[model samples]
Target chain A: MRFGNKDLARYPFLREALSYVTKNEFKIEDLDNSEFYHLVEKAKRKIEDYVFEGKLAYQIDYNKTHEIIVQEEVIIFLISLLLIKSISIDSVTKKFALFESMRFERYLISDLDNSNQDDKTVKLILYKIFEDLFQTKVDLEVDIFNFYKIKISDYLDHPIAFQEREWNLVNRTVDKGYVYLDGSEIVRLFRNELYLLIIDRIKKMNPEVLPDMIISISDSLKSRWEKMYPPLRAPGHQDILPPCIQHIYNQIDKGENLSHPARVLLGTFLIYTNKSMEEMIDLFKRLPDYNEQITRYQLEHLAGKRGNTKQYFVPSCEKIKLNNLCFETVVCKGISNPTQLIYRKSSK
Target chain B: MTSPTTSSHTSSSSDKLKDSITDSFNYPHSVEDDPNKIWLEKVFRKHYFNSSSEIELDNYVSEHEFGFRLFDGYIRRHLNFKNKRELIASIIKFSPSDIFCSPARYQHPSASMDQKGWIGADLIFDIDGKDLQLDCARIHNMTFCKNCKLIEKEVHTSCSKCNSSMVQIVELPCQNCIRNLKKEVTKLVEVLHDDFGIENNSINIFFSGNNGFHIHVVDESFFNLSSMKRSSLTQYLLGRGYLVDNLGFRIDKSDNITMLPNKIYYNKGWRARLLSRLHLQLKNHRIDDKFMRKITQIKETNKIGISGVINNQIQNISVKIDPNVTIDIHRIFRLAGTINSKSGLVKSRVNNLTTFDPFKESCIREDALVKLDAFVDTKLFFNGTSYKIKTGINNIPEFVAVYIISKGIGDIYIEKLK
Candidate 1:
């Protein structure tokens, strides 16, 4: 069950990996040294890549990948986590978790490649990991996709966590308290568990003691992020908005304080629907924390009339969902954006 | 599930039933004044005392909690027994209106829910006739007014004699509901054996006293499964929440076009069952095997839609078993061979499902002829005897009388000593 240091780097989130990486107690001051700068920069670059490319470009050299690279990768994840926490955007953090989990799974699945490890060795490792992580019983059923027969209870114990009808228990082959599944299903299930594990580590991290260098870098990245995607004005067509947007509008109308992303989603959606600055600001009037000047500035920024005038498109449905904003009304099913919600309702 | 007002049930009867009764009683309307409850208590006490047959006690009876609803009293629970003798002792002591046993075996069976050290529970599937909406209910059910004692042959907003909302709807499940429920059970049992790999012997089917059936899967494999796992099992038999995404089938949502698969991975699971049914539907046409590849699952001519056809197929294959019954680990399930006080009928084990007839098989089997007032006109075939019951006093055997009275559609006709 003991994972080598090289394997630990690939799965730094593993319980065994915690012992190797956390050997020395850390302080905020430790992150400032030149020696740690490369790690911090590498960590920042990973986030930048994920935010822009929508992928984590991480690779594991199964053989001859240096122990130093291993140690570095392990420590970099911790640094990357802190950077994400310091940046403090839920959308970025959530998406990064998904990408990072998939990246980790890619290597974990790669380790089971028959060309790299003998059949016996592959099974021993796979069994150990399965038992260690999920307390599941698995037997290799077919060669391709590392197909295995996993006990039904193990698969169904948290099957709903998948949230997809495909992962529903009714759809799978279950016999003698076991479910037959391919490597991808097993790998994705692992990714879901790992995502939770990573989120937990990220939650425990204190962004308050963040070093000045990390904070400055995060601020610059955040601005670059703001300019990366832009918004613009649209025709003021309808009085009503999509339910998701309407829900937020209603909340603001009732003087409820909108969360940062909630405000962003609402503002951009309003601009796309062609709400004027005065009209948009008027909706914000009942907010408990409402101030006319600040509201005007925020709405103006959203309308792309403020600094760095690269107009932002209304936030995509994916982004809204990641930020937990979309109401996902049935009428707006295929419409990918909130502005489309207007067109959809109008067409109907 | 529908609009606020209850669905209608109508009554049909002949006044000839009134002259037939010499003695009478009513329940559910006035529980304190119910002599029927007293008669039922006597019936249950006599059955348990005389029947020396083995009471079907679940594994670890000492660790199982028991609950009982005593005649004319509130339900009592948190009681445990050491053996069948002790359980029977308690039953005789109470002469309970209903009996229930916990599916879960706990370390401290009598302890509070939180404190009860839960061990494991048998997987159960409850399929109730009441849960099923049958077209035949109108044929066999009626609405009876407790105030005016008026029986309406059909659903009425109010009684004809008095405008009373204090009315009860009663049902005598026709052959259609029974046949439908039996089909559900058959489908469930097949899935348990073929899909779950549970042995046929371990799957015990029981007539759930009244208008339902309780299936207890006593297999050791499922005993340790958590509620979530059991819920998954329920979903499997229920044939729901199956998305074609993982099944290698794709439907373009925007255009509503489905990319039908020529070769479905139908070797096992739901797809296997689907393929079998699809085979039967396509068997008559020889063009199926040739054009089956061509027409495997393409868009049906536009109107009804592909989703509709696929959905109909899925619904046809789905078994109607209650997920709550299986998922609830702490449920107090009714025991077989025990009376469901609601209907005064024993929840007997179905040894041979096809031959199992509840009306003929389930009863107190006493020789006494009891006179009862029929609140509704209904037909009954009991112990090889058939009666076209009318809405009036009628003389019937003790078994049929108890069964009807417990159903809230009849009351004992008490002879006034004039």
Candidate 2:
């Protein structure tokens, strides 16, 4: 999905790329004679550099590349790749300059009293850039203990970030080097890394000068992006969960002791839906013998905090049947797991 | 079923019996021998081709992968035939020492083709004498250390003399072991019928001739169970990884008592089992008087005091089964009519498993009397008779002779009696 009006206003380069790709209409249009010749010459030079001098021989200016190309689809295609990090800037300074040129520095430094620290300021700007580009809203909390390594709390001053929040929200005692982000937030960060690979591939391609070729390439890349990040459901979509998961939710709601497999299935489902560890522990408190410490430990373990830190996926339909916990409804017929069912129902 | 006719006054009757037993043993000599081939051919012809009904035979071989173990310990596997008669003919020709068949069905069982995918597998449970905990006579077994060449009489994982970890334990099942195996078989049958909803007709129980029992479920629904599903079933049967709290008991905060939902008693599998066990425990007056009074007073409400004693009682009831055999779909079980190589007794299928005694029902040649040359002093029980013999030659029934020889404690000798 394309960025909204607010994101466009915040990042002018994206708006400029969008205008260039659509010819001011956000739709493909016939390239002007002069613009077409310029694109052809640029494509020819890129092909020669790639073929003879290798990858380092050619590099596109992230800020000024729109001037060289006039095809609306090609411009949009490249910008989308850049947004996804499929393309990279030559250096960290150049990357910071590109972001600064997009007017990201004003909003980033507006909240901070001291924005002179280059690394921290750049990280904050990058985090905001990712949030705006992906339209993902992250709840920035000042957590004392680190739940996951890379977090906004790690970059922000602890005293300033924790100023008005409750003492419970800020892990005041533990002095872990890194700050905590929700496990699901960490997943979102990793997803951004994947998007960067896609962008890098697009950045390396010698642009096809033909409008038809560029249009088809743009359409294919858009399809790939859609497939890579399927739209996540809103919290309200929990009502549409598969019958087996709904049954588990009902059991947990009633404070009933769940079987090991049942607990695992519920934990996996909640984790996939981006529920925080505390929220999961709260849900588990309904269990008859719920010990808060033990519940938190188990939830953290499922969240990939313990041992090898490998996150587990929900068990397949076959595994559910094996556990004798399959409570299949008509809707579950063609699906293999609860996650698939969730995605299917929510997409519909 | 054949009973030997011998004249009471004949002097050489023992010699004739000995020679007849020896001849029967020599018939299915090896997979390549002509005598074995001819004998197997006759057997297949009689049982398969000339049988009165073909429906039973057709149903038996339709979805099975057959393998034949030669006398030399090499197994000829992945053999499939079009019809029951053809399969029987092939078995007869080969005259394998042990006939084994897979419980799993493949698209092209005998062909190495890409379309060869597993359709499903039969739900098979095996209860072997080797795994049974018996308190009867101890049969001599050997344990050898691979690392240090140390030998021990009893089975052990590590060598005592050299402290080597590479020790292998070999088990020899005696009559007592078979008796214990029968007990496990009974438990399995009860659990299958009561808990699993399997009908009596759908269950096929067979004695493995040497030590164990194989229970095969022929129900159409059970054929397609995945290995993971089968593994879960094994776990349930073995009582290994069950959460006891999931039986639906919750502590009622109002009265500070553990309350059981009424629906649990009405439920079918483990819930019902737990309810019945609770009833038995209370009725038997096993608990202390104070706890008994508490339970009795709250019997109508289905709530009782939460105590450690009650929790332990709930964990005590579960079926014991051999988990590995049930989970493995490709495991080859011995064919019913084939002779067990170790015991020299036929792997017989019993019509009425509950009343079938292994000693009498599993005997291949009941009437043949043989002489056993014992290497050690041993007391043996077989076919309603118990014999205690010092290290010497003793005349016994063929079944007892085979049992002794199978245990590696004695050798059988056949000669013409003067």
Q: What is the i-RMS of every prediction? A: 2.7, 22.3
lDDT of all predictions: 0.69, 0.52
Best candidate (score: TM-score): 1
Error of 2 at A131 (Å): 41
Candidate 1 per-residue lDDT over residues A1-348, each given as its tens digit: 465666677767656665555665545567888889978888887887776565457554445555665666767887888877777655456656767877887876786653342456456656766676667777876543345777666776653433556677887766555677666666777777776666667777875677888889888877775564332222254353566776775564432457778888878877776777877765665454455788888888877799778577788888888767778766677878878867766787
Candidate 1 lDDT, tens digit per residue, B46-114? 877876263588658899977666665444556778988888987776677777788889999877667
- Report how closely model 1 matches the true complex, as a DockQ value: 0.39
lDDT value for candidate 2? 0.52
* Model 2 chain A lDDT-worst window of ten: A165-174
Best by lDDT: 1
TM-score of each: 0.73, 0.45
